[model samples]
Target chain A: MKQNRTMVVIFLTPALLLFFAIFVYPIARTVMMSLFSVENVTSSVSEWTFTGFKNYADLAQTSLFRKSMWNIFRIWAVGGLVVMSLALLFAVILNSGIRFKKFFRAVIYLPNIISAVALATMWLQYVYAPRWGFLTDFFSWLGLEDLAATQWTAAGNKFWALTFAYCFGMVGYHMLIFSSGIEKIPHEFYEASSIDGASKPRQFTNITLPLLKGVVKTNITMWTITSVGFFVWSQLFSTVTTDLDTITPMVYLYLQVFSTGNTVMEREAGLGAAVGVTLGLLVVLVFVLTNLLIREDEIEY
Target chain B: MSTAKREALYRSRQLNWRKEARLLPGYALLILWVIFTTILIGWVAAASLSTTRAIYRGEVFDFAKNGLNFGNYVKGWNSQNVSVFFMNSLGYASVSTVLLVLVAAPAAYVLSRFKFFLNHPIQNGFVVAMGVPVVMIILPLFAVVTQLQLLKQTYTIRLLMVVLYVGINVPYTTIFLLSFFSNLPRSYEEAAAIDGCPPMRTFWKIMLPLAQPGIVTVSIFNFINIWNEYFMSLIFANQDATRPVAVGLYSMINSMKYTGDWAGMFASVMILFMPTFILYLFLSEKIIAGVTGAGVKG
Candidate 1:
């Protein structure tokens, strides 16, 4: 048997071409574009004027940019905690000899399939509707008039509401990951531990958590990537363009470059590129950090 | 029938009381979650079928008075240009899904079979590209397209959207199929080669049909993704005539909110999601199996 060079080359050319055009070339250009001032997004290569790190400096000084940064950090940290714990809990429960497993899993994962726009609208328009909202209805039914009357999509609770809704949609995907991870661990470990008089919680801590180290890393990295690209939920959540409560970095970037009436005067194209690079850096940084943190050896089954 | 029922009728005889008691908390939590989920989407479904006036009056579920308003769907489909968005998405998603398989399957098969010098590097690059946020690559792609004046014309913009959709997914599709192709027994290829069948023909005739199950599962995932994709479509197809349902529905919802046509708004929400919703209804089991079994981490 021989390696067919011509066949390999012929087969791989189309994929390789797409990869270079889409991922390789664009990423390289974006990183370079971030360092310079471009006349416009459509500006040709010759129009780019070098202004090293000025875009970064400008972003640091801009308060809206700063606020967007703060908002996304909260979303990542707080929302991450909520989604991970809930996903883990649901996964554990589903794997615990429960009936209706298939039905529960499918229904729980339902929100992920729907467009985020539609899902967010269901939250903002109905769940958070001041007049006949789900929250108001439920609370009023329980005889808590004050809680029912409280506005949910209003500024005070709007950010947390956005976070909550986003977390709700995200849990199912991560739950599937954790569920599959739990299923991979042989039942014999639990059986032996139980025979030795270990409690369920003890078995979980001693066996499941350590065994799931790689999955935890995968989930964290994925969570960070999705968090960085957060846009549609925040966009649909806010009425005004610059709603301070829910403005994420992606939304800010869109407003800066893609939308009209942007406040930044010099070159929003550069600023947008800078924002992208900053986000790309965040993903890489977190990936590196999580790898260092979750350094358990992969145990073979 | 009565004896059969009576034989297993005793609650005490049929039940595992202590185990059931132990799992009671799990059931309670899950049931509460399920109930909440039901109320959330269920209310939205009900609201879509009632008039805005009834919705505001909190009479959506009071069907005895205000019966289902099927007219809301008509308004959503016709007046709002949802029909255009939906058709555009259907075109973009279906076309790109096919091209993704066509472009990716060959590369996947080659990489999985042949040990070329760049094979490992290419594989690693694609896996990393899967994790690369769209933000990183979008600006350059946008710039080049804008400079090329591709976004100006309707046809070119449509072509651009399809191309982008296919390109963005090429890595994922290729990587997914790589594992699928690798797992296939190589004896078929050997038998074909021994029979003097060329490598290329073998791939097309034998190996491809063999990989149909994997291709179908991954295609289902891809179809749902492209159908529901928002950010790229929002940027590229921002115009009234070209936008996908997700973005189209956003602008429609804004206007409808002002018009106070709440029923129409919810109805459009249904229109936006119905394709993928119906898709999942049939294939939820297959889709879930893919997610759990594979190393797909999107």
Candidate 2:
């Protein structure tokens, strides 16, 4: 038993060390950096002046920060609900003895695999292009030409465009999850329900949904985490727009530090770290809260 | 008695009609959605082949005049040194994925099979790691990489990228493989060990083959992640030569003003997008199975 413990430690050490250095240590550093005022990022002497809660106070006052927080919530609410619902609907349909299921599944999942850059570029040129875009044409066909001519990445439309982009990419994975969950439901139950003259919707509500509770919980958790930490997609879709239009907290923080004209400026590192710490805490808080609210007993299949 | 029988038959027919009516809308909605998604993906393929001029003219459905031009592809491949970027991405993604599988497989095996102290904590730790946002790590990682002089050399930077990849990905890969490893029959490993096979040999020869499907799934996922990664590569590999295709395409798009060649940009995107997209097209079943299967057990 002692030998087994030792072996386990040996196997785990490398991964643990890397995780601490790369993941945990950085978070600690972000907190520490947030407390100081650095003249320059690279060569500044570390004079730690403890400013307890000052950064948080400043964050609250910053409109950009507040706007970003609201945007995050908005995207999660709209995107999360739509994507999960559509995915579940599609999954149920595909699982119902449908022909060409594999082909449809492949078509849906294809977008998820495309590189973010490619996907973003395609959307920008083909769908959201101000002049002569397909989406505009479709809108004209629907007598909504004025709406199509409006800038998609603009603040008014940025949220919806970003949400649509996220949902399009996510539907495939979530659909598969829901489909597998549905597949696990025993056929005997459906047969028995039909024997009892229970309608399809009735069986679905009583049997299928109850059986799929675990999957629903899992999907919700996954989507919540992914949505909260969303960075790349936001960056890709919103970079062309005004910085304030769809600036997520992470991207805003990144721009403050790296993309700003002078890296050696007095304002970069400490402020960037402050933003980072705030974002991290927000993410952790959301994750814990969601889990607590949705916590349920594990259902064994 | 005859009237009672007629009434029962009429009731049965009514029930069947109502059931079929309810099913019609569901099937229609599903079919419509499937067709809509198919048309969109088909548009992507057509756009990849069309000239920028044709696309700008909204000739998506009019493929007869502007169909199947290889000019854009050739230009995309040669222009902006994309071939180098492609090779760099291939090298980085392949190496990183292979290393991740190598490091993660044994760790997953030990975590799954043993009942040692800290076992549950280790698993929980990985779950927490999955929630750690990557943005939080970028600053400190930049400092560490610079301090270690990793940024100066390309090969060292790539190696560190692999290590970073392995570190972040181990959580998911280990968890995924853990379930598969645990599901295998214990008797196979026991028999091999009893037959004078060493422990390592037993795992290598017996357990490894048994876990091939899980390994393949994890590897494919890791490959896609490493290939598609953008932010880390953007930060670490500032040089064009060392940049992967994701960053390469970004810079290409950024430089479009100077080039004024929209066709070139679209072509480059198509080139960068093809390798993974084609793999997805062919192996979608495997990919979906891998992801869904992992989710179920997890």
Candidate 3:
């Protein structure tokens, strides 16, 4: 028993130390930094003037910051709904005894494995580009030439375009989740439903869906948290239509800190920390809310 | 009477055919969606292979006029720093995966096998950490890295990345392996203990081999997540020689105004996806199992 305690300490120390250094300490510093105002580009004085709640106050008043907060909700609402619906649909189709099930699954999942940058680029060049992209040409060939010329990633269409892109990239992964959930359902359930003269639609609505509640909850939680934490993809693609400052809150903060060329200014640091903390709190709130809504229940197969 | 009965049976068969016909529209919609997806993917592949002139001419579908060539691939490979980018990704992902498994396996074993004062709280903490945003952690990490002067060298940055990856990944890996380890029958270990084999020896020889599937699943996940990670790599390793393919591709795209090499950019994107695509083709079952299996069970 003594040896076991020693073993636990030995095993856990490295991970705990690294976590404290990388995860815990940095968060503490961010909160502290958010309380100060920048004095210079390189360094700040130890004479810390604690501006109580001013940073948060400033953030609330900024239009760009407010728009970013709204944009986060818009993206999550539209993108999350579409992705989940498509995932459920595909899961049902794939779960139905289809030919080439594995091939279909692989094709659907291909986008998930590709890097986010690559996936975004592929969408921009092939599907959403206005002039020479395939979708444009296809529409033009169908005599909707003007519609074909509509810029997809332009400011006018950016929100829908971004949402679709997010959904398309995410559907395969969530579909795979739902499909596995469906696979676990016993064949007897379907057989009994059919014996009782229940139609396919009825069976799906009643048995398949309720059985999949757990998987759905998991996917929703994942999507919500990840969407709130989103920085890279939004920055990569939306920057085309949106201002560098008008992207997601996280990207907005990132640009403030890192986009300065060569001159390390500390002014943006405090503001950036303020933005980061706000975004973090928002994400945590969403996670907690979602967790509360998604109550745990065991489904017997 | 016999002729009438035969006619009635044939009528019932006709009604059944009509019932099956009602399912056709759903199937048709699925097929149509698949076709659309295929066209999009094919167009991207063709764009990657075409010359800039062909692309400008809007002859994307005219494969006969614009045959495939490796020129774009060569240009992309050279211009995008694909060589260095690929190496950096490989090193970071491989090193992180190895260390994650090494730390997580033993930790998971102890948590599952032994009862401790803080076991439940530790488990809960890991679950909570899973939801913590990477953005929340990045600011602090950036501050820490700068203070440590670890950002000055590529090797040091990579080492820090490995440690960070392992640290964050611990919660998931430990929880994952915990279930597997605990599901293991305790009788085997008890017998080994009675036979005078030390606990460590039993773990190395008996439990490790038994928990191979869980280890493989978790390791694969760690590998994929690290490989696909863009944000951390973007901030920490933005320098050209150390950038991973994801960040490298982004920089290449961002430089298009200066370079005007869209074909080269697309080609590199295709190349960057190759490893992941191939892995998906071969081991999709495992990937699916790892993701959905882990989530549902947890």
Writing each residue's lDDT as its tens digit, candidate 1 over A189-277 gives: 99999999999999889998998888898899989999999999999998788899999999988888888766654556989999999
Which candidate ranks first by TM-score, i.e. highest?
Answer: 1
User: How do all the candidates rank in terms of lDDT, highest first?
Assistant: 1, 3, 2
Candidates ranked by DockQ:
1, 3, 2
Better of 1 and 3 by TM-score: 1
CA displacement after TM-score superposition, residue B96 of candidate 3 (Å): 1.1
Q: Individual DockQ of the candidates?
A: 0.68, 0.42, 0.44
Instruction: Look at candidate 2 and give me any clashing residue pairs.
Output: none
Q: Candidate 1, which segments miss by more than 4 Å at Cα?
A: A1-3, A264-266, B1-15
- Across B1-298, the per-residue lDDT of candidate 2 in tens digits comes to 6999999988765646555565676668867766766665566667667767776777855778977877777877887778889998999888878877777777888888888777898888877777667767777777667778898887887777778777778888878888889999999978986897766667778888899988988788788878988888888887777889998888777687256566566677778788888778667777887778653442
Model 3 CA deviation exceeding 4 Å by range: A31-48, A238-246, A261-268, A291-301, B1-23, B60-67, B295-298
lDDT of 1 by residue, B90-200 (tens): 989999999999999999999999986899999999989988999899899998888788888888888889899999988888888889999999999999999999999
User: Residue A13 in model 3: shift from native, Å?
Assistant: 2.4
The regions of model 2 sitting more than 4 angstroms off are A1-10, A38-47, A141-151, A239-242, A262-268, A295-301, B1-23, B60-64, B257-260, B295-298
